[model samples]
Target: MSAAVTPAARVERWFFPLLPNSRIAVLRAAIYLFVVVDVLVMVNDVVPKASAPAEFYTPVALARLIHLPAPQENVVLALRAALVIGALVAATNRLPRLLGWPIAVGHLIWVLYGMSYGKVDHDHLALVVALFVLPTVGRSHPHDHRADERAGWALRCIQLAVVATYTLSVWAKIRYGGWDWPSGATLMWAVERRGTFLGEHLVHVPELLVLAQWVTVAAELAAPLVLVLRGRALGLAVGFYLSFHLITYAAISIHFLPLVVCWLAFAPLEKIGQRLETRPVSLRRGHLARRAAAGQAVAVVGHEAVQPVPDPAERRDA
Candidate 1:
């Protein structure tokens, strides 16, 4: 007779399967790389805030808890330097936990410091989640052949965070904007405020703007499908989600690097990491072809494993 299933086991089965370390390793690299790029590229505008008058530095709740100093030039520069260097070291998978934990703290401080000047964004949710979780995952070698539950846990959590970003975005719209948001001239309002070159001309088209508003809401509502999808379905859904972001960016000139990078959690990153860490593509393909020709079993596993090919001679004899 079997015993009753425990809550822990259920959670493990559903959320934390054994996976190759390569996946999390890739995720780790991607998240940290994005952290560096995000600071230098996407969030660089916030650096100027450090030089603003002390009167303008209104810290957020987290900043208050930590009793952060006023955003001065030296402080911001120090934080930026630490973040860039920490992220680069962390991406190398060297002293991961030691480097990772501090990077997370630094990045959080970085985000809070950026927000201290007034403007804030919800886009950092995924990046923040990745930063905190990566340190918990510990060491995950790229060429590992065995499954790792710890690696799976971290990747899945990142994936869930990615899904929640889109899910909650629409929820916010509905919560704050109510039902009229979709039909309303939301696009027109946005276009009038900070519209890019493309959006400026489109603002005159009332019908198109209205259509875009509804489409935006509908697309966001579909974001939760990433949680339940797998295989080709998940791939297609992610592709569409990315396309939607691109379209919106073209129209509004907004970028969500954190959210975009988080989507890597859904990718077959182990296989990708393997390819990236191995020889050139042509040489790697030749190696695999030779292996196949020698009647040896060859298979690749990612989000799911491909069926191993059987030797032709064995099949013929059977």
Candidate 2:
């Protein structure tokens, strides 16, 4: 004897309930970190060279990846700035659902532009994917004190995207490099050949290199299981992924924002906020107390206010 549910009602019922209250806070923190990192990277790009040459702009590379026409100079500049600013705003949770799409799209454009310039770093690929997915989710707003309905959907999307990148990367290595990735010495060879920053140090230890290869395979193969794992299992899996990224950064000097973003996966946002709240209230009150003390009056409990103590010189004069 239940009444039929309307399409709108059904959608809302399914979507809203699945939304995690902590997701907004976690996502907001992630976005803020991302914005700071991105701004630093952009500053590195712009400050090093006042005018980037056409080759450095990488338009053709971008065009191939994004399937868009090569943007003119003015368009490229505008898009780059937009991506940085949009991400900053999005990170702060300002007009999230409304601004997310444009910011995401704009960041993609900026990523493409960078790739087109000359180098397409693999670390950047993960960031491109993260940016692509960020707009689709909801982040918590400090002002509103309410979770956005769409944020729940976005959280699922981000989780899937993280898994997909790992799965696809493994697939790519196998498809392009062949299934012998685990057994063969190809990974070690890659490390030895591309021994830039950390690679140079690792090349001396064959055992470390072998360990790295096996761990990489295991992490990639196990990535899909993250979605099913909950609580501690999920935390361990996320930690493994982070370790993988940390190793990669050390070995190759590659910076992967998605891996950093994936830190949110392990973070118990609610628990973090709860622990933060446990900090001594007196510490915070001390600031206000100091300010009040600076003024001429002191207010005691049950009393409105009392005038400041007169100086010894003033008392002597009186």
What does candidate 1's lDDT look like per residue over 109-191, in tens digits? 88888888788787888889889988887987666646887787888888888888878889999998998898888888888
After superposition, the stretches of candidate 2 with alpha carbons farther than 4 Å from their true spots are 1-22, 39-67, 117-139, 142-149, 196-198, 205-208, 272-318
Clashes of each: 0, 6
Choose the strongest candidate by TM-score: 1
Clashing pairs in 2: 24-140, 57-117, 58-116, 58-117, 137-154, 138-151
Q: Candidate 2: count the clashes.
A: 6
Candidate 1 has which clashing residue pairs, if any?
none
lDDT of each: 0.83, 0.61
lDDT by residue for model 2 over 107-161, one digit each (tens)? 6655555556555545444455555555555545332334556655555555666
